[model samples]
Target: NTQVNLGGGEGLAFRNIELGTGLTEFESPEVISLLDASQFRLLNLDEKTSILLTGGAGSGKTTVAIHRICKLCFNKHVLPQDILILVPHHGLVLLSRKILNSIGLDQIKVMTSREWFRNQSLRLLKGIGKEVCQDTPFRVSLLKRHRNMMKVINAYLDTKKLEIVERLKRSAFDDKKIVQFMKETAIIKWMKEIMKGDLSVVQKMLLEQLVEELNDYNAIREEIFKDRKLLKNIMDDQSELITSNVIEETIKHTHKQFLEEFQEEDSREHTLDQKNISFRTPDDVSGTIDLEDYPIMLIISNALNGGTINNGETLKKYRHIVIDEAQEISPMEMMVFGHIIDQERGSFTVAGDLAQKVDPISGFTSWEDALVDLNLSQDLTELKTLEIAYRSPQKIIDLAHHVLGPLAPKRIPISKKHHGGVLRTIGEHEAHILILINERLEKLMEQEPKSSTVIICSSLDSARRYREGLRNLANVRLVEEANFTFKPGVDITTLEQVKGLEFDYVIIPDLDFRNYPVNDYSRRRLHLAMTRAIYQLWILSPSAFSPLIPNE
Candidate 1:
């Protein structure tokens, strides 16, 4: 066996170390093959022990994950409600649910982390017999600035009498305040603006665009805040994860905040008193809970503070957890989960590849470190790696390994016989590319009755351009990140949206260097897209090739 690198181009690797054996007691009822012994062994892992499953592209990591989940619930008799399957995005949530439902394993809970976090916040509000409103007593006014988001609060504070500003000066918030600020990435406000020099072209455009969005939402936000009754029912809302406070703070960080100009039924101007405006900006004059009220806060507040609520029933604490795409999980999120997950049971399985981290700034370095942050120690935790490249052919796998550069994991190839797919460069314009894509679609359709094809573009905007011209081609539709259904047809989407998804045949149009340049992130995106094809992959670009993909 050839040794592979683990941390990118460092040329480092460890000896082959096998863990526990595959399960012998349990058997799945589904029609499948136990062809991969390692996968079988991973499924048989001791349920009581926490596990970290790390592997390379095309390895049967997801295959083993779903199978183990079924084995626990269907065969092991674990209560369905006690199991939680967390995915990175909504599309994966749909995919996981479909996988379960196909195996007749309903009742299992599947949700994105953001959805889970939002639900937790909703529970807290319901328990207190309150609601989450944009503004309970009206958010007062909106402020727009370029860099200093906290400036709005400061500006509001400045308008206040000198005595009030003095009281808040240099006042330090609690630990959670710091934690929340970090989570929002709003520290940039207090940190020196890139003002070390003029803003870069990208930075300047991004900040200005943010201001435009803030201005656009002004009227909608104002109308939402005008409902005093809704505002009165509000307790704590989301700060970063879809809570009222989170949006307010984000808009603050961008330095472009806005509120609607409230109008009475009689067409008269409506405004808060001058003193009240000051109170609302920096203080909670409406008594609505600040978004700083997070799920962990609720856990501590309810259990420790002996808080009560009229939510009728309590939110469930999952006894077993399955985190899919665990590589994308941030350090802050892991810290939060460290608190909520049941420590006594400790039946957790996190699945992800460190190398497959397509996006930078993920705050993910290593599973060993995440284990410590997650409070899972070597004494109780076991590791699993499915090094098989089951999804791609030898050519595709080789291309991917090369593109991964130095940070690729020490992946072992287990897939040898299942080879099918073509990776080629078509020198053609968008019009020619569309013709070729349609031709491939016709071939796939003739081969199978209900075949699903996905033509992934560089971005949503690019996808729309393709979609607008080829709308009549085989049930064509744009796939949004929130899309929960997988119909038998063509789907055009972005690189970010297609994670944890596969297709019968895949087409990557607009594969030029201008769109997908030669870089770590773009290369990972290309690698990710390449691996999604179960049977076929066709790359179309105006140029004869892409630097991201080497000439074979």
Candidate 2:
């Protein structure tokens, strides 16, 4: 019999180690001890170690990670703030936040890259704006010069109206068109002459030109009777010409100067600023402020840097970082976050099934290569695999596993009483299939009494089509690309948009090869769609595409 020593530096090889010669009954302490010894051999945790927990859907990887975090926090005396958890999407953030809250770690903060960026931007804006305002005299002078240049241009045009009219007529222009054309042609030059060299003068000039152009349009339309087509063409040409010129000038002359100013202000403020603003909000309470108005990078930078130099104190402290749907995070972003945290002391957990990276258009793909790409191999100390699934039934897991190829291991045990559902293979007829799915959803809703039924599609187009096709169906809701809220009844949404969500019954309207190409990303998306059902899952695919599934 082979004997092996587990754990410790000095150990015999498993094949060479010998077991003691003993005949113990099954389920006895001796037998259980042997099993426990082998299991204990598999569990190893060391200081400053990185772990990769990989498994298919329904695998206990999440449970294991959570348990591991709890162990580190309670047993190891690691502060909750010292653990960082990164989830794939905002929806997963919500899910993880709920899980953390339920575990009584309510003070643990959950933030997305967007949230981090907004906080940083606000910090920069607060610090830089003061310096910017201190140079108010220069700005006011520039503004005044810009205003004078605009007045001169306006007066020049007013005094030389006939000459301007002649130029416009020569160019086959009407009064409305001529005014627009002159404004577009002369605005930039006028501004440039006024600033002497200040780029802001160009911005101010553009603003003045825009106002004058609008007033001119209004004045001429009410004052002059000109040909409608000519007026329209002139107005269109003028607007296009002015916008193009402004953009080109901004890029060529103003952009670099503005950037220099910003950099100068940033450098000065860095020395004087000592505080940074930090904002936090609960998942349920929506913030009314628009995030698009701020630069996301600045916000994240400030937050990760322990708040801006404007806020007196930093926000919530979190050490454990969990990034769910890890497969979707871009490598650049992953690198940024990895740099922000002290890897030796902080525990970063990334949970994502590679089989569900669907949003390739948004640069979303499997991040398995991140370990090598980011040179994180040295830091990754533990690689754990979770194979036991508790989400979907065995049948659904099986179907998803078949489509996901080798990535999805056949480890999830079959449920004893899975809610068996039909997998219909339709033909090129997508419309008829959608109708059938709608009918099934309606019937299911009538029978189930609850509004937990959902129709998940592979793409936004498919979701919208399903919604438009079933618009008249009562209690049926559609969640298209722009819609955020999840209403009751039969809801239709794309797979990527509905991650970390579940329904009592999920009907995948179309799972054909045409829709879900056998690419890395598409297959993962299909897997995500299949696994999002709690009780039953129905997949409708074309007969030709049925062979895409691996042999069970």
Q: Which is the leading candidate under lDDT?
A: 1
Worst 10-residue lDDT window for candidate 2 reads 8-17
Evaluate all candidate structures by whole-model CA lDDT and list the values in order.
0.55, 0.48
TM per prediction = 0.65, 0.52
> Going through the candidates in order, what is the number of backbone clashes in each?
10, 47
Task: State in Å the error of residue 38, model 2.
Answer: 10
> RMSD for each model, in Å, please?
16.0, 20.0
Residue-level lDDT of model 2, residues 178-286, one tens digit each, is 4654554343233224346433444445435543442232122212112222222222332333233332332232222233223332233332366433232232111
lDDT of 1 at 514: 91
Model 2 off-target regions past 4 Å?
A: 1-50, 67-84, 101-103, 118-317, 342-344, 359-380, 405-422, 425-431, 471-475, 481-488, 541-552
Number of the top TM-score candidate: 1
What are the per-residue Cα lDDT tens digits for candidate 1 across 1-552? 111111110100000111111211222222126336656776776677777887766566666767677777766646777788888888888777776777677788899875676676565433321223344222222111111122322332223223322322323323543344334322223212332446555544544443233222223233233333233222233112224563455334322222233222245434664232222353322323222223323433233212332223345566678887887765545655665566776478888877678745444657886787677887887787776665555665666677676656566355442445555656457787776666656555555535566788888888888787677666777876649357666788887887877665567888788987877778788878876765566777866566776766
Please list the residue runs of candidate 1 whose C-alpha ends up more than 4 Å from where it truly belongs after superposition: 1-32, 125-315, 410-414, 482-484
